[model samples]
Target: MKRIVPLFFWLFAGSVAAQSPNKSSWAPSDNSTIVRIHRVEQVKLEMPFPDGSSFKNLKLDEVMAAYHIPGLSIAIISNYKIIFSKGYGVVTPGSSRPVTPTTLFQAASVSKPITAMASMALVDKHVLMLDEDVNHFLTTWKVPSNTFTEQHPVTLRELISHRAGVNVHGFAGYNRNQSLPTLIQILDGVKPANNPPIRVTAVPGEQESYSGGGIVIEQLLLTDVTHKPFSAIMDDLVLHKLGMINSTFTQPLASQWRSKAASGTNSNGKAVPNQWFVYPEQGPAGLWTTATDLARFAIGLARACNGTPRAILSQPLAKAMVTPFNDGGAQCFHLDPINKGLFSHNGQNEGFESLLVMNWKTGNGLVLLANSDNGEYLWDILLQGVSKEFGWNYHFDQKPKEWLLMAQIVGVDAMLKYFNTQKATGLSENEAGEGDLNQMGYFYLSDGEVSKALSIFKDMVQLYPTSANAYDSLGEAYMAAGEMGAAKESYSKSLALNPQNDNAREKILQLERK
Candidate 1:
């Protein structure tokens, strides 16, 4: 949360005039300029209008400015082609550079799908097999023998589908001036690598745990098997073949393309430290691309599924790639059942974010990229807008109703007072849980509003007195506020309520020692 904009106020701002300087030169893709322009104003979240209407028309500039998002690029595809492509907001605050359809953004975890696609190229050539043990292909560093992996070897299929039970959820990436590690160093979690060692934590094929670490191993496998650089291989196998001409998997980005890059921004509407993060782990989180370019990739894949000659994959292989290993996990790409067979993927870097979605049958899709931490939330809103305009029959998640309603009718403070008086009458565990207030407290804590956080935590404990989590959260607020005595008291209460709360017990010991 930024001090300049309150969360509730920013989320529910009234319509402001379109402030986008780039709006005047609107350039939608060929054949659908008018419809696409209208779609921009149809921006509505899942929530109904204040007066109970189904949707509300919102201006792109107003929403972007409200959320402090510096830049956004969007592309809509239909019938195996891009129907619209446009940009909103500036590349950086107070800069003359405006975001364009071609503005490159860090693709983040969305790189996984592209990497998977390239790996499929190897499979097609009979150089690799999906079901074979990945360790057999590794030449530099191998997956260490462990109790969990002894039962079943980690396979390429399991790794790509996130069923390999590997560790390391993602990478925070290294800053520009920091020493960069080799691929082997990152896998071994040796010096200069920020994340822990990539290792099997659970029985392979038993469960799915998303691991960028697993993807890194696949990256290493591709390089070892092909005897080629990861970026060069991906460019040849996927990017060039799919006509993703403006995309690259190169780390730190090339110097010639630097001028076309969008500057990364933090949640506070400020530039990220050192501008952007350098991702050496290319398989999971390294890509520089535009929304339009991603749209082309999506369209090409959808066309391939329909047995189009331009598809990089055969019809059967394309179908298998999008199919889930189990009901819970997508193999190479994510599938959304509610959106009528949409294959979707979203990614987030330190300050950049992107989303790609396409219905293989309809050949309709959306690609969105933004240069801010808040881009994730903004993308949800944009999805709702596109769904409504195109009649895509997709569902959008609703905003927190009770919180919004209470915040509007009664003040934010009134909800706390009402909770204190009403007990379980108005609030349900699902609606206004201790976790909700706990998260709100941390939001303020991250913004350096310790007093506000303290008040929120107090209200949480007052409402959910029996919950150990509530008292534990209150103790953390007290500790953050530098009130050692109160923190100790809250921790003691938490420990008394739940002896399983080792965290609270340790905190009490730490406070007494201090």
Candidate 2:
């Protein structure tokens, strides 16, 4: 129950350049626009309170420093053209090598959409069928069939849209020294493969459940059908066609490219061990790309959506890529209901994070890549700034959870008073949500504010008495405060509510031993 809080929440809560042959001629008249964007004030949280108070605006550098992000690269698309692309900070912390537009970063789950795009390209040809059972094409490894797959066979369409009902949400790539698993070993979840067996867990096509495991199956299917490496297939179908010269699906990234790749950094801004993890699961997470290269991919999709002839993907296929299979997801992207024509995806690896948002119809998009785990904290703020500057319709209306912010800016007593006041008024409070409050408690606990964390956890138990997670979190706070008896009692209550609370059971054992 003691979750790893995003650095932003702890602080507030207490919390590109590579061009394609189809490139547009549009160019900004001056550097003024980019400068203004960098200086754009931090987003103001629209408090529901009567006073309407907001936080002071901070510059981009200030925010980056606060979040401990080592490096960031960005590319922006407008009017179906890349109008701006640049990089800020260093490729590694304390290093003289500055991030450049061409510097590569791990694309993480953002690789999924590109992989999905490649699959669709196969569909466009006669090579693959979206509706056919994937097992038919999978010669090397087929999805292990079970009750969940008996009546509902998995299809490429379902896999691309995350409706395939497979297990294993994602993968943790191997360290440099770890022995790499063969694709077959990975599929069987055998030794050297860290994840469990990728198998059907629910009725396929019944609903959307993200399955990176399903994507690996797709990777194998492509390889089995084409009799080629997964990385080469992607290049042939998508990357080469789109002219994304700096992108690759290669794992243990080619030695020639390593010098241009940004070193991944932890939340504290320290370099990841051996600089980065090597992901062999190219379909789900393996990608080394620059912001400009990714922007080219986005622009290609946009052009295809506009029915441009000879685009990387056919018009029909491109439209299908953006069209949601369900309310939540399209082939590999999530459609934002509030932002019309917007399809987006975000990615996270061990010490890297990324985001890609595009309005396919208008050819407007943003790509953000960073080398630090704390990178996501800057996304919304930067998105808001970009949207404002570009006059785009994108809007992020959710007010950030500001309990930690209030505690930092004002005193804890005042923050608590405001919380109680808002609760008494019967108004929906942003800070009162179960997840938000739990995150706030974990933030405090991480900051070594044991008393503050205890108070927050106690309130969570009061607010949601029957919630097992709430009790589990309370138990963690009690244990952190060295109150063994109270910790055991809270753990007991948590277990009584939900016998499946493994963390609580583990804590109970640890406390008994003590």
Candidate 3:
């Protein structure tokens, strides 16, 4: 493990943090391509014009700072092998502990894919059937049957693909000091469980509705059938088998990996209280892993998909894992339409965000793990760089909304100018919306630019007068700027516009108290 100087000093000094030691024989002979990817900072606006001037290249460190990301790690898989992996920035804002390739970050919903893979492995072993009723395998608890499940039973296939119509889209992990819920409590959504009960709400296998609660049911199924803990089952079925040594499904994380774990940070770059949330919902949200390890998992899946002998999954099962169900989901991964072979999954926990995109057929992909709420902000920019460097056709479209990019590079004034000019030309009809401006406002607020945030939000309110969210955002900006009277007024207007705006109502109460 290596330590680096604080983020401010390191960014100002333009120094490289110590690189993780490469033990893989597949390491690239020259890292010039990786260096070039790091230097890629240009943002190209997707304008109607044929020729658009590219924004100046911003360094990765500078981008990290602007986004208030404390730490990030990336791993690139090329030709069915991990060719490059590295980490950047300090683990926690002011800490000297540098993020390393092995540093663990919560996989969040990314855990779903791994859990899905484990389930598929069971299918391959004849221990579990994909189409079998999930309740058959579950001993601890069963999905409460209702009218929705009368015609179509909730099957493992449906659960894995999120077609089970289960309620609760995601889970909010418990605080470190909070009493943890058992698997049964989480499914039943009882005391100490912060979510509602997981139950089928629609006809199973009828439509796709992403439900982490559905995955928790599969977790219990695995535990019951295997007669082992979810974490142990994952270790034996997937992680250890794939040589993902740096990954674990254990909640609260193992003590041995504590020092090696990056502390989750909020969008404003502050460390999460107690460092990170404890996700007891292991199947849906509780995998702690490194980018390199995730890349290994991706590579292993790629091998299995290609019919490699003795791979973690059988050929048919592996192919089925990526095959989109009737509802357009492939087990846990989502297929990319642009590159038909690419399957990707993104994850977000309290203060962590992660993305895994891999083309199983071509064996090319990238894993990005960040200990910040705003981590996904860097994905498109970094993906562009990777696609350019590797000549990969399966990258995110390089074109970004003009105003949003302007907000990042030129600040509120330039962003508004471009936005207004485009609006005058009627070219901003689809691009410039209440949501875009609201996002821009929050970006400014998070960066501590109160006046800039206020400008954006005020304009947003003017643009969408009837939008309660716009007024609510304006109230937030006013509150951040210490204009309590204006904030109260804005919240009042928002609450008036939409009586269900509890956020605005709460803000009014707080302001009234003040």
Point to the candidate with the largest TM-score: 3
Ranking by TM-score: 3, 2, 1
Report the error of model 1 at residue 208, Å: 1.2
**Candidate 1 TM-score over all chains jointly:** 0.84
- The whole-model lDDT of each prediction reads 0.75, 0.78, 0.78
Q: RMSDs, each prediction?
A: 5.3, 5.2, 6.5
List where candidate 3 sits over 4 angstroms from the true fold.
1-27, 31-35, 41-55, 395-398, 401-410, 429-432, 446-449, 465-468, 479-514
Better model by lDDT: candidate 1 vs candidate 2: 2
Candidate 1 per-residue lDDT, tens place, 55-162, comes to 444467766765557888888876677877877777776577888777889988889988988888798788888898988898978999899889999999889888
Please, what are the lDDT tens digits per residue for candidate 3 over residues 41-77? 3334343322365445545666676667778888888
- Total clashing pairs for each candidate: 0, 9, 0
Give each model a TM-score.
0.84, 0.86, 0.87
TM-score of 2: 0.86
